[model samples]
Target: MKKNRRRNKTKAKLTTYGEFLILLPLCHKEHQTELLEQLKSAKRPAFILGKEVPATLNTITYGQLDDFSRINQEKEDPAVKVFSILMGLSQEEVYKLNVFDVFGVINFVRSELDRINKLFASIKVAHSPEEIAAGVENLNFGTFGVIDWYAKRMGITNQDDVYSVAWIRIYTCMKNDNEKAEYEQRLNKQYVEKAKRKR
Candidate 1:
């Protein structure tokens, strides 16, 4: 039993560490090595003030990412946003972190942002002006667009457990249905295409 628990902790830690490694160069080529060394030296993927951090961020939904992008326009609080939304922690949990951990998180996030900002800075987004704007009357707002789908699919209910459903489970259901449909409406379009080509 003890061996199993130890193995699980190591697995979770590696998974979490890998997540950071995958998201990096979040800054410059120089900082990439620096960040890698930092994560390597740190006891990551678990215990910010002895509170176990989740191994994976599968709980986060696409909808939450959309909200994060919109609300964090200035990119002022990457640590808070990541800790809360990605980690699935509450605002109060942010208070539990020490100043050192918080600083490390901020550095990691800012490095990524710096890399992104530099890449996109010179690229001009061209917008063609619209001649005619569609009216609200033209838009059809369904009474149960989302509800009608999930009701038949996930057996989703108005309950606490319903909210706790992982996004991957929902996405898997959709992509599996897509596979059954001969890739007519792929939720994971790129993956489906690439995997098909391999066959």
Candidate 2:
């Protein structure tokens, strides 16, 4: 009976420690300072319940803080590169973006790159004119979709800017005569619509 009780007590203490770790990341810097102080004050009593709780929690919290800073630093440069290349922004402009905005831009570019890669793969294996046409259509759709998404995300309503940033040169590399003409027509229509909106 005593052994069972001791085991259950240890389990409960571990559960509490787990909860503390989970919530630690959600705390603001100021709140985290307060939490650290509280943990220090509670450590003596916590040792009575379980010797591991307070020391383990402190070590984990400090490790998480270091990791958080390191991750943000690591992500910054790659995020800036993606923004600069895809959006045609200068490095200085990319550097001005906040961490959250940088992350959003990186995610958008990564997903769009995946989509474009898949479209290219489909185009490569196309056996007939019809299959090629279908692939071209899919590719065009994804291209324009990405441009539209970027326009919205960056608040760029200017059609010219959007076109300049578009991967049209890369997109046209594998196109046939008919597919190229079709894509040109779509772009012209989009330009016309954008001009009308400006008026």
Candidate 3:
């Protein structure tokens, strides 16, 4: 009985998605300060029950948060990068998308989509949940398990839903075809300029 009890106690240290979801509202300035103080007071490496953990909205700056809000507020049109990720389109494909088209289901509902996008940016992307490619931790949608964990906590069972939101946000910031082309052009110009200088 004692061993089982101890095991149960240890399990509690691990967090769930609902715990993380709660942090969205708590990321406010006043709430954040309080949470930070609480975390500082605790100081333990392991997660504290309902207190210290990634779900605790104590670390983000207001600017980072505001950016997240804007991202969420934007319409999820085909022109939006998130839509591309949700649809599993390549960056090249996303780059060619015109915002003019009003397609079916391309646009997300205002409020609910905002809530979902804000969470992805503020928590999953910012928190380092999953890695997209090896040695590319900072890449968008990189935190795979973290997203899953968040969904589970919030009782969001649809894996596709979670992945779609995450992918879209990450895709927005991703280097699309135009950006890649521009970069490559710049590099080529630089190389030619360097060669002329050498001569």
Record all residue pairs in model 3 with backbone atoms less than 3 Å apart, i.e. clashing: 17-153, 18-153, 18-154, 82-168, 129-143, 130-142, 130-143, 130-144, 131-142
| lDDT by residue (tens digit), candidate 1, 56-135 | 43555534533344556475455567666555555556545543355455454445445533543333222223412434
Once model 3 is optimally superposed onto the true structure by TM-score, how far is the C-alpha of residue 160 displaced, in angstroms? 14
lDDT of 2: 0.46
Off by over 4 Å in 3: 1-80, 102-111, 115-199
lDDT digits (tens) for residues 90-156 of candidate 3: 5454434322121111233233355555744443222223334445554444345545544665587
Q: Give the lowest summed-lDDT range of ten residues in model 2.
A: 49-58
RMSD of 2: 19.5
Say which prediction, candidate 1 or candidate 3, comes out ahead on TM-score.
1
Residue 147 error, candidate 2, Å: 22
**Model 2, 65-183: lDDT tens per residue?**
22222444355655445444444455566444333334444454445456655654654423357767677645555545545655675687864465554243333444443476567
The CA lDDT of each predicted structure is 0.48, 0.46, 0.40
TM-score of each: 0.39, 0.29, 0.19
